[model samples]
Target: MDGEIRTRFKTICVYCGSNSGNRAVFSDAALDLGRELVKRRIDLVYGGGSVGLMGLISQTVHAGGCDVLGIIPSALMPIEQISGETIGEVKKVSDMHERKAEMARRSDAFIALPGGYGTMEELLEMITWSQLGIHDKPVGLLNVDGYYNPLLALFDKGVEEGFIKTSAREIVISAAKANELLEKMELYTPRHDQVASRTSWELSQLGYSKPPI
Candidate 1:
């Protein structure tokens, strides 16, 4: 217990590609992140798919004696659930909206691995949710091998152009490795002014309760 890492998150949702990228580094990062989560005794909530990075990470976490929950949209079930390769408890939602809401409701924080459009979409939505005060959970990027440098630069450009506020930009935490990213996320505190009160949002469907004042 001398060098154990403590985390505030019980379940963290991960957004990643259903298909592993061309490079081996992407797959490696996914596995590394899974190990880190297991080491910290944190459960995982991710897009349901037992292929590519999704499969790698889910299997790693499940094998490490941690809970793994995969939430997938009904429409994509056929594509994502190939060859009966599903891992852990799988939840099917009516649509993408429902899937995302369920994932958010179940997770305490979020992380995005190197992925395509779907991954970017999920990551941005979480950040937007934080900006809108739907939740104050930390959203992090496992920026493995500079995979997210361009995206980060784009974010900085948004700030320079007054499209994004300074405090809101801080909502996204990034690092090149899982351990460092998680450490930073553990220290994250929301400093941005929410567009609306968290309780004001009609998040009942997502099972989010209003915080006690």
Candidate 2:
């Protein structure tokens, strides 16, 4: 196992949609997560923007007196529609690679709200990094309305097919509610952590280089 639970997160990275999805609860989860982060006094690190679920959480947490750091890629500014409404310090990076790197570097842990490809990309990258030992921070899903159930099923499929080990699959934490998820994250300890010490090049043939992403 990794170790004892971390007492303080300091900052948490969140990946979410630039567009609020079809459901009100998706937005509700975003707001709820924002409030939960504030309640815990954890700063927010996320894809930078002032719209959709991203905006909701950033504005909510910032309003609640928590620092928010928004890291964005230059290529996505026009796509995410950056505006004067941004709630916190915004750092511009060259591309998606830089943006993801910065978010992972700044966050103590990660949370994913309902989103699209970009959101999934960020989430999966974090999970991959954890599996590769680039980072061992907790990675979680808000599973709003069981939105992520299909992904979970796919992961199970990976395990059953002998592509993903049972122990490696345990790194991800999922919950229906914000508080529950956060608690799970704080209590999480990494197993199979030693695999991270091996380079991806050495592990790729072992079918350990990446997740389903």
For model 2, the local distance difference test gives 0.85
- Per-residue lDDT of model 1, residues 7-106, tens digit only: 7989999999989999999999999999999988999999989999999999999998889999988889899887865679999999999999999999
Which candidate has the highest TM-score of all?
1
- Identify the candidate with maximal lDDT: 1
**Candidate 2, poorest ten consecutive residues by summed lDDT:** 204-213
Instruction: Identify the runs in model 2 with alpha carbons over 4 angstroms from their true place.
Output: 1-7, 198-213
Model 1 RMSD vs true structure: 1.7
- TM-score for all models, in order of appearance: 0.96, 0.88
Give a tens-digit lDDT track for model 2, residues 128-191: 8788776678999999999999999999999999998888899889999999999999988889
- In the predicted model 2, the residue pairs found to clash are none
Clashes of each: 0, 0
Against the reference, the lDDT scores of all candidates come to 0.92, 0.85
